[model samples]
Target: MTATDLPAKPYRNTAFDASINNPSAYASTLDDSFAAIDWQASWLCHLNQLGYISKSISQLRGLKNDPAQTEKLEHTPDIIAKVLNTALQKHADALQQSLPQTKPALNNQAQTLKFVSQNELPEGEAYERFIGTTGNIPTRDNLHDLFNGSIWLTFPKTKALLNYYHMLEIKEQGIGASRGRVRDTITVFDENGAILVTAESSIGKALVDFDWQESLVAPRDKWDEPKQLNKQAQAAVYIFGHALLEKLLHPRKALCAHSIVINVTQDFFTLSLSERINHLDQKVADYMDALLSEPDVSPRKLSPLPILGVPHYWAENVQPSFYEDSQVFRSGRRSQS
Candidate 1:
């Protein structure tokens, strides 16, 4: 059977789907994105949210500690509990509104902890000996306590891949049609072997530079002047492109790099049978040929050096309408627009 006839992969995520339906999903997703990319922005956003919670808790704790506020202290936990409960309820309502309605399966068991709910302090008589000098926050454990639960932790690969895809889409076609530039394109595949994301990047310089000097003089009497040579930055653009596809398909496995070429002419791009086969599946090669043959302005297809893995999508497949008119140029049979 042909590749097109291959059976579709099946995925099951009933519990996860329901869990994301809660309002806390937004907070949790943001938290996950921060940890996955190690982007400081995510943590800063959470810190801002936690700051408000910390301030409210501190004020209440102060009132509870004062002897004159003994009556208020007695009511503190209940008030805190009510506030947390309301927040959680609001989260649920928001989730319900945002997500398409779907019946929850009885087997769904994902539980989210409410920050101000009745939580018994982690207790044990042995704590006096084993707890060490590191004390629980001398002040209330506002952010500390909230982060300990499993829900607050990030899912590494899932979040990384998702964020990568989200950023890619935004970079390509702006939020609508006119706002964004298509630079470089990336496609990610699940280990399950299905494509997860397909993205295009706007052409931007990703370059590294270095200079090395060597003596160039006759040895006997005259001192030689040092000469310098500058080399073109080895293109990471193609390496990342090839590696991304290979990793998505083989995942955690390594593959040797291979060279392939596409030639761009004034009107059409051309690829030899061997060059086409080297970079992508035969079907993709055929698709690329059809794409470049269109009447749109041709872009340059640079000479291919050694790059690794199967190409999931060709740069040319991105419709020419997405790029500026002046950028079109041809090399071999490929168009680099």
Candidate 2:
């Protein structure tokens, strides 16, 4: 059978489900066992090898003991640079050994970056054509880049495929401030979790059929509450950019960032991690092909893609009701002027 025909597989959601009836039963699975020193050493070594000493160091500090530091670092690029450089000095010996030489060659690549899956490198001509540009690749020095790079390492194929489609759409439609098909394919994380809804899917007739606005606007304060947790998990697909895995653990009728929220059983996460990646990579590939092959295809016609973002990332001018507005949740009742 085709990949599309294959059953949905379970994956871990980084957002803890405090509502789970028996937390102890799943507690062991969440443990990463590494101490702070070990975690720092490991990341420093990895980033150094990749020539991202400063970025890795900054991320470790910003994310020192918690993964949620990403939101704080997002707005403080200056602080990130300062802390990262300090980290490089503090861990000089480890960084020196990780590098190929005492000094590495540098280039004039652009500072404004876009992330692509490093795992898919040594790519063919077709891949290059799809990408349309070079040097936009993200570096490890930035928290955003580091988080994105982690996503690539974990979901290489899926990330690569999304990049492929993103570039293709950009080539066809050209870039603009307005949201497009390519932009929808990604999901960014915020303080609460992954943000699933985008500008396009947040309004019009679609809003009424599904509780998309309500699902999207719920705050972190209510996330742990059973009803709200289920609501957020149902509407969301937590692809933790800071971590190595993506979460689509719970099933819901709500729209996901990329496609439908398939029914993935807990047994799915039981498989080896590699097996899980293979399963998801194939599923995404199949979905992309099916999506593109349809007649009269457009971003609006396809499943609402997710581009997850952090809190301040979306907090600027969003309607307060989206998160605080109770009126947006009303169904089947049109206002009488």
lDDT of 1 at 154: 15
- What TM-score would each prediction reach against the true structure? 0.22, 0.36
Name model 2 segments beyond 4 Å from true.
1-136, 170-237, 240-259, 263-267, 272-274, 295-337
**Per-residue lDDT over 17-133 for candidate 2, one digit per residue giving the tens place of the 0 to 100 score:** 221222222212111222222322221222222334333343334343454443343222232233333333333334232201111012221121133343334544333232334
lDDT of 2 at 256: 34
| TM-score: model 2 vs. ground truth | 0.36
lDDT of 1 by residue, 1-337 (tens): 9763343222223433332233122112112211222112111121212343334344444454456645432222233333333333333343342211111122222122233332333543221111111111111223322332111111112212322333334444445433222112112111111110111111111000000000001110111111111122111112213232323232321332222232222111123222322233333334333433344412221222211112212222134332222222212233334
| lDDT by candidate, in order shown | 0.24, 0.34
User: Candidate 1: worst 10 consecutive residues by lDDT?
Assistant: 206-215
The root-mean-square deviation over C-alpha atoms between each candidate and the true structure, in angstroms, is 22.9, 16.4
Question: What's model 1's overall lDDT?
Answer: 0.24
